[model samples]
Target: MNTHPAPATRETGGAIAPHLRRLLEFVEPDRDDVCLDVARGRGPMPAALGPQVRHLTAVDAMPAHAPGGHGASGTNGRMSTVEFGTGPVRIADGDTPPAAATREERRPHPLGPDRTLVKADASALPYRDNAFSLVTARFSLYNLGDPEHVLRELLRVCRPGGRVVIADLVRGNLTGPDRDRIERLRDPDHPGTPSIARLTEMITSAGGSIRRLDVFTVERPVEPWLAGSCDDATADRVRRALIDEVDGGPRTGAKPRIIGGELWFTQSWAHVAAEPIP
Candidate 1:
């Protein structure tokens, strides 16, 4: 198994919120239902899904190191900023930082008295068979060395006729230049996201049926993508490559077309709902 930590995009919360909303729209958990958020980094979905479910479980592998230390601190990892919109604009400012921090602070048990956080692996969930009524994972599927094994485990723990929801970025979703930029920066252990067709097959083979699949488009301003991090070199490369893409279309091949707007990149997400066989 790959022990390396995966790189989480700065836009995780923002990019994932809409997809969570959509998943909630379809699953609509009852107050008595048991829900689990697999690979629950900083616990976003659990916060949203907790109120509606009888019990919420947030699980992930124990971090080997803390945000600023060498020892694993459970969920406290490095912070990355995500900016939205065009030139010289900050979607979230100083006040926003506190709010974001507050949100994360509440992450440990955002669902309150009824929720639990577990340090565990996705491929071999510690829960018993048919233990939960609903299971959800976001932007986390690609990190697994065996996504199929993990999906099967999720299905195993879910109750008969219960639901499993997965949200992830598609490999070809980004434009050429942006894709290249990501590929270069991406860690070797970072498994490029799987295609939609492959994901669908994995779910069905595990004795689950697909209910709904949707793609959400998110556009981030170039400046934020470049300047959000502390690393100057990465920021510079991103900035220069983006400029090159703007100047020369496919001719440059260094940048992909900015979809939605001139300075924005696209993230394609697939939300799949599967039901366990009764």
Candidate 2:
């Protein structure tokens, strides 16, 4: 099975930063409102999101992997978890050890008293019904057991007319061969990402109205792409396959396009904003 190294924490953050910024503009949270960043990996969004809203609550299913660390077994050491909130953000640190105990802690952003970190599942949020005015999930739904169910839960927790925005990678966004290889190698635990059409249908069926939907594509150099995944033999195979495909020829209608400094790979993405029905 083909495999790639998990993206470096920095690259992961960079990959999603532009997308998150665009979504934030559309969501437009006010200083008096509470916003929740569900499945917040490494607290990247919260760093930008904390100052915009009155309070920002960040939660993850598992404690973020210690930065620069290796594996789930803590072989490379642990990273620090920093809380950033306006009026006391409540953080829930699920099953992972507290950030303090980890050996590889990154310094917390100085956002001050309003942030709370919690260990929680998106489908079964611990907050009260209608506790938040806005909810955002960044590239997380694709990994959940039931993304639609989580969307319903996101809708349920939002106050009437509040908005829930979802940002995720779409299936057609990656290089064609790379995309196929990924699907073949992907574990069952990693559910395939949903297409834009399905996501829209799920949100509408859940009694939420889509206010805006947009797609953005980015092309990255091959080196960075190869560097992003695991460094194992399987990962090497996958990387080679990707390179061969790119150099071999185009099977999918159009030939590969060159962008920036590398042979281009396309990433199709959609951002959907849904408002709950009153």
225-266: candidate 1 lDDT, tens digit per residue: 444333677656655665676776333223334534445544
Prediction-by-prediction clash tally? 2, 31
lDDT of all the models against the reference? 0.57, 0.55
139-205: candidate 2 lDDT, tens digit per residue: 6765444777778888888887567878776654233344544433322233455566777888888
Regions more than 4 Å wrong, model 1: 1-19, 62-109, 171-188, 222-230, 249-262
RMSD of 1: 12.0
Give the candidate number with the greatest lDDT. Answer: 1
Compared to the true structure, candidate 2 yields what TM-score?
A: 0.68
Candidate 2: regions farther than 4 A off: 1-17, 62-111, 172-180, 183-189, 222-231, 250-264
